[model samples]
Target chain A: MKPSEYDFVAARRRLEAKEKSAGEKLTSLEDAAARVTNGDVVAVGGILFSRTPMALVHAILRERRTGLTLVRNLMCQEGEFMMAVGAVERVVTAWFGIGLPWGVSKIMREHVEGGKVVYEEWSHLALGLRFRAAAMGVPFLPALTMLGSDLVAIGPMKTVIDPYTGTTLAAIPALYPDVAILHVHRADRFGNCQIDGYPHMDADIARAASTVLVTAEALIPDEEVRRHPDRTVIPGFLVDAVVPAPWGAFPHECYGLYEADFEHFDEYAAAIDARGTAGVTEFLDRHVYGPASWLESLELWGAERLARQARRAHELVPATDIMGGLSTPPKPPALGAPRQSRGAPRPPDAFTGYA
Target chain B: MTTIASPTEWLAVVASRQLRDHTTVFAGVGVPLLAAALAQATHAPNLTIVVEGGIVGPRIKPGRLPISTNEMRTAYRATMLTGITDTFLLAQRGALDVGFIGGAQIDPYGNVNTTVIGDYARPKVRLPGTGGANDIASLCRQVIIVTAHERRRFVPRVAFVTSPGWLDGAGGRERAGLRFGGVSGVVTTLGVFGFDPTTRRMRVDALHPGVTMDDVRANTGFEVLSADGIDTTAPPAADELELLRALDPERRFLG
Candidate 1:
């Protein structure tokens, strides 16, 4: 039931109070890494390349933690974020999508191929599985999908028989992560976070975790929260801690804050198409690996670097305006190669109509 | 002989091989598209791939095609342009042989749910809208489900009904007199499973190569039976991969 008499003004004040309080601690993301221990199950929220909380993950890597398992719906670009920093021992996910600058690095792929880390693959639905189990207050759910399909064996699955029917069924256990991290657009005191844009599986991850860490673009007033309650994806009851982090979804799109590095993504996809993972590795090291600061990622691809990368990668670069002053590198030929003037006289036989 | 391969590759190979020669197979987005394209190239050269938007065997671009309508790019040469309803009608009239789909939840009885992740009234999560999955799953001669393996999706009960597989449970389907052959098999990123003949309940019929029984059980949501000496599913050959690529230039609708 909708609350009667919305008090947006009071909600706004409450949010401000929460943000001011969190600002006092100002703990470096690196310090937060200490909370994750070896062999702990972790779930990081976000989808494709949108709203992913890389800032928190970056802090974990800075601490160089290891022997921890990551469970989630999507974990790709930051895979190297786990591998390079030695913060992860194994990864359980539905699929891995890595691009050039922030995607799966060469080292991570090699690790997956070399068995340095266990690659426990699953379908995108698995993310929903965890959340559904959490919401249902059940241990696990049964299913009949992907049974005869390749996911069983190719995924290296083991089979068991249902005692009830004596018929065999594939049993995939429900995932329960000890920690879940998410990045959102706004949050109020008490941890009710709102996502202004496409929210992939962020809410689901938040529900499945014992502790939820949130990084928001801003801390709105409690009154504003009441005014726009529909925007809140996670209720205050589910969140543990909230930090206001700008550009939190760095190298990825954050609804109102920063646009996705599409030019970089194109470059990364080309790298995967051309040199495979090695190219992807070199690209990540230059942009996502070194500093935990988001500014550093932008700096790594400063104007000149982005142009050069785009040229070599043969991609259509984004309009400079969309870049929001990353220090534009000398502009290269505009992407789609500016169309020739329509009024120009056609060259002698240039347009011979095909027979 | 060929044996089980990667989940994605296995799906491409098996689905392609199963489609008859020159048959027009109507596939939903994702694995079904991969299966149809691979089959067209390797097994059924004359097969016509009809995307929801009417593109027929048009070259598929890369990345995920979130909706069935995205196949329009490949439907360039399609014999017909149709909407979701039109496509389902084709399946109902016996104009299509195979239908590939994905689901959010499935029960032992073969019932499928792509709507909500939890129980009917209250749900933990609500997914994208269901298009023609119900009609295709219920009307098609053979329906192939392609999704990843998990306990949540392979649950014993679905919170909602987006598509009917076995209706209630064992014999629930026959009792309801549900028309159309039910789900033929499930191809996951892990292994392949089929329904038991007697119980009409889903079961593990084979495993992909290098995968073990324990591995399958570890990820599956429900208890499953194994064949006396479960055989290994065949892997895709180089030619099959090339064909798959040809049909899907951008690698759209795949893992």
Candidate 2:
């Protein structure tokens, strides 16, 4: 093939226009849901329901989309809520429910028992590693987790041996989701998102999916996005759409946002225990389907509850609280208390030596 | 009127008593949190509590229990924020001394069954599958098996082996190539059980206060092994109950 004539001046103008069109990335939740198709494997971010994109998910549910494969880590309220709304067909990940003495949620258990959903469980490491593999464009990730367990036999996981050593190893095939939805503390119109606290696996999921939709608590100015430039977790080019949804993570913590609504979760769990699947629907109808939008749903919680639960990052200056509420230790633990197990955490390979 | 102790309260204290100094405990939530918190405050103040999500040594807040190990509270004051790979790598290297596990059923050999109740392909009841519990049970140097003591849960043979405790009656775990760990204790609402040294089978080490040997045998599906002399467990001290309640003020997980 012969090279064609290049137009440098016009190309430069187009690049400048693209950079200035940052506001174009901002869209409504309805438009974000429009990007989702039935049967799409959706990667939902947030660990244990903390910092989930509630508005985006509610909008997606209103569209009446079903048969979607959900990739998740914790089976918290999001999994159960989706199941009640008929938004999921299968779940691939580890853990559902809080564990005994409460046990897994009745809704999740009933769905599995009725064969409404297939549960493919994996170790947290294996699940996360697979997402990283997909993000890196690899076929599989070799890991040491689930090596001598039954999850490998029943799920997509398999055993591969090192040809040189003849030692068996576990592998999780890459999971490239069609869409990834994440909720973050803040982001600019350009989709440069900042996750205030623990980013369980959002970075990996966003990179692995073909399209990334972010629902942020606030859409800040370009300066705020670049303030701590090096701390930028999600790069703008990777994002497909961004929505500003306040209280985006309801019934769960959002770091400097608000405390996890333990009151509601308890009520939901008890309702399920008392009425089984029927209880799940009642809670959903009242809280989920009934609301016209995420902000409107705030009326259900009332202003007093929200104000009481509000947790600002500055309040917890030295340490980041999970629920954003303040907590003072009963007593400062003895600094050099007789050492236990000499296994105090060592710095990771990446963080070390750089110092 | 003085209130009677609930099973959860009794079990948490009984489980916490098992902790000794200089031991790393692995568990996620519920009784494990209550027990670990109680131990850290009262007896073993220096205990290093490890969560599966790679959060190690967090000063767990008393009034709030994180929903899962994945929650940021688990990493609140954690000295090391290693992910699952590093946490398990440390476990495989024989760092953890005690691992706490919950199960649906347990056989005499201590093989845990959390997969299904009746059949393999089609089960009458399907449980949420293992989430690194298999590794916790397989790799830790010792494990504290916490579960109900119903005839249904204490079975003759588990339907499926989700986490290996002890394979047949003898050297099954060793035969399977597990590098470290075995069932050191089984903490139940009724009593505590330890494995036989020579036979490697579970036997009653001690019974909780007010529990009878016949009661333990009746609740268990399999034969309840007992030695010539079995000790009785002491009741929870007044302070222990006070601390346990502090760890879970709202009874969020305990209830």
Candidate 3:
């Protein structure tokens, strides 16, 4: 379908219809997942391996939601698992891979190849801009990306001669998801969300979606949230429900909370390698379905293992003591300082010699 | 003195030499990050490393390199932490000097394909489609592709153009309405490649030490051209190897 055919007006109406109440918005994971019905355009917040809404995704899977269109900047284990279990019929994403040592996701590849799923590819910037357009209530935004790439031919983006510059620009349509599930560091009972470290694309995703469901690591008091108004990425008015799921983005790292469970990824990779779709089913049975709740799922991995990951997270980003403010301002080497002077003599002309 | 550098170490070292000091580089994950880290640790101390995950000017920690760009490790000592939209907007406004990325397939025209191995619809191998690659390639001042050189990878024509190089030929980018940025070179395991000034076809500009013309010809699917008096890529120096090894002590990326 052409991007022009998208129901922008209906999307706007849906957003307008949502209650803007400032009352307690806290809810259960299953209840929050229930906000997402079948065939909904669901946008998941966070980038690959970080801050992904895995708890909500698990909840959605257990709810047996199907025919959903999954959206994200980068597709990781959550998207792969969703596709593996037939929860997703389509995926609109920039990239889909396990990344690094794991490489591409075999399940995603098989699904796409077998014609069981439709994958709509877009450049990362374009996807982000699309969400931004939706958040801003604009129909489309012009961009310089995907001008000469095959994505131009395949994706929804179309080029138009710029009226001002006489240059061609790819017109990216505004993407309004039916529901956006986000994982945040903290959120108030009233649903004001704050994210530590990098806010991948959650802020825009929250605003762009008609219904926003947030799975936060902790539910802080409204007074605490008010103290750091500058850190609130998702305002309460935009949020419909908030599920306080600790270690919500487990197996995937949440900045300042814990490191990614590489051992679990290794186990997952091995499982998929050993048995394809059946392996994914077995994983879900053992981790997702077998356990009644997200917290119960966490118990599968012993406390020592979870603690080690949290310790590693602290080590990686020493300034995790947010309430106390930055303990030590990062001191990077002086720009252009000759740090290598003590080692090897600088090559005469490393840049120009090759050409 | 001979430094027994692994293939990836050699690629990282050669790729690092491509960057100038104090330039803002949009670095992709894996080897690109390793090379950028090495560059910052060595010659380009002032180099600003931008990850698509919105991390800018991060002092990449040794041995704890982020497997994914958005991981907390990538944000350690980062000069700026912005959203993905704002970060890519920086590139769109021509703030980035270099874009360092890797791909599964590259054509003679330097066009890269990380999307699919066979057909787009029903593919033999479906890759992790273009993330920020096409954006970086389209907006950055220049792009450098770092990938393993092999016959299957160096295709006569990419099945799908996830990132545009010089599309078709000489004025291809211009004809296609791309006003800024084009591939400058491709740093590979076997050699360093450059594009022809007029034709824009891939050419062997510098062969890495111990790699032969026959190796280039045999591995590349397209007709490989050679630059006049093509210089041999300098071997990884002792200090460069030390820095690269230090960054990847686990050999997670260096291998």
Candidate 4:
């Protein structure tokens, strides 16, 4: 049902009250991990390896639960870790890979080939919109993609005749996960979160899930949270738990935090190369279980490696500044030498065609 | 080999030529990225490229071949950094002109298979399924495929079509209610191919320099028809090759 004016008013009052309430929403990573029972559908927030909630994901792995259904943009990198641990019995995603020589995921490929993992693959667009349908409280979303492609047959999608026009279009059913874990740069005591770079499918999945949990790089004050309310991708009202997890996305980048730890990826890749799925146990021991805490895991990298991973402000550019200052039009391309901006009025883009 | 260059280098050159100046191209990583960057640096400087991961009007980062479309480097100096939904919605509305696709296999009808090799449920090979390649092929006015020329890559029918290219041989996409344009052409290591207007089957428009019809026919698994006036693909000019090398000095894509 559509929310009424009273619902909005009530929600506002509760938020205002929470602002003054004793602020301590920080939960232990282990506690957060325990919430994820077996047979739960978990939607992870990230694209490739960027902004994945690694700390919590590791915690879940340590818990040793099975029968998980993972939903994500691409089942690769960190998602590959989940499959390696035998946590994910099924994956409902678009693409799966580590790129380069290894096109398909290693152990995940084995599990699927061995009839242990059920791979429910769809086009990336279909999966994104399916989450959107859940967010909007709709049964399905009509999409222009997958109608012509064979993904409609292999993946979980159906074609419906567009009621407005007599044309047939592909529709993906809603995918509301039991729990959605997002990694953010900062959050407050109230659980309001801020993502540094691209939200990707973070905000959508957070809303689409039955429960919203977040692992943040830092826990900021209420003023810092209110400083740019517009930047809040996950609102306090929707967020159920927040864990203060610095370097939460360790191997993967957290945008402004650092770059992807290719050293670790390379090491993992080398292990796979040496012994296909046989090397998984040693890999898990070294990476997932070896370290007691997420921070202690840094010992594997040592101090010098950490220094190189340090982030500079300028290098950590925002994908969207909730502060909303940047509206500058794209500058013309810089050719041969650095392009001298002669203030030439460029032509309209191809979207409108040449003017 | 085109004028005795590697297959990938030839494919990159031909793919870049397909892009028109003052148009938007929705492209992914590797050769597609190189093709767009090459076109920008040389003939089509005004070409706007939308990296499928949310970058619109992207200028290639000086020295990197982005592995994923959403790679942080892909967002560097981009015109607009929007989310996934907004970027693709533009294509759905028929805004983008060209969408570049790289596929595991290309069938006679220009249909692509990136899903699996053997079968759907139980497969010999599990190729990475469509990662917005379906949307690119379905919505763009024209889709350009860049891949190597191998008998295995060219099949009579794709094991599973991940993206449509005239679905069946002719009128299948139209019958399936595709709103916008279907596959226009394919640029491979050996030659350039386009769908025949009547049959909608892949037909050779041009061959790489020094490559013969026999060479092209031998590489393809299915029947390949030649157009009435086919041209030998022009060899990569020094300037174009230089730009491609500069963009990817590491030879990440070229190698």
Q: After superposition, how far is residue A94 of candidate 3 from its true place, in Å?
A: 1.2
Question: What ranges in model 3 sit over 4 Å off?
Answer: A1-6, A323-355
Model 2 CA lDDT for position B87: 73
Error of 4 at A326 (Å): 15
Per-residue alpha-carbon lDDT of candidate 3 for residues B121-184, written as tens digits (9 for 90 to 100): 7888888888899999999999999999889899898999999999998999998889998999
**1 or 4, which is superior by DockQ?**
4
Ranking by DockQ: 3, 4, 2, 1
Which residue pairs clash in candidate 4? none
Candidate 2, after superposition: displacement of residue A25 in Å?
3.0
The model with the greater lDDT, 1 or 2, is 2
**Candidate 2: where are CA atoms >4 Å away?**
A1-24, A98-103, A147-149, A269-291, A311-355, B1-7, B70-94, B169-171, B174-177, B197-199, B209-212, B227-242, B248-255
Q: For each candidate, what's the DockQ?
A: 0.05, 0.25, 0.68, 0.49
Better of 3 and 4 by DockQ: 3
Tens digits of lDDT, candidate 2, A296-353: 7666877556654553222322322321112111110211111111232322222111
- Candidate by candidate, in order, the iRMS in Å equals 14.0, 3.0, 0.9, 1.8
Question: Residue by residue across A1-355, what tens digits does model 3's lDDT show?
Answer: 3353246787778777768988889899999998899998899998888988999999999999999999988989888788878999999989987776886888998899999999899999999988998888888898888898999877667888999989988888889888999998778889999888888899988988999999876666677677779988888989999987777888898886678988888888898999988888899999899998887887787666776776677676653343224111111111111122122333332211111
Pairs in steric clash, model 2: none
Top DockQ prediction, candidate number: 3
What lDDT does each candidate get?
0.56, 0.71, 0.84, 0.74
Angstrom error of the Cα, residue B11, model 2: value is 2.7
TM-scores for the candidates: 0.48, 0.81, 0.93, 0.88
Report RMSD (Å) for each prediction in the order shown: 15.2, 10.1, 9.2, 8.9
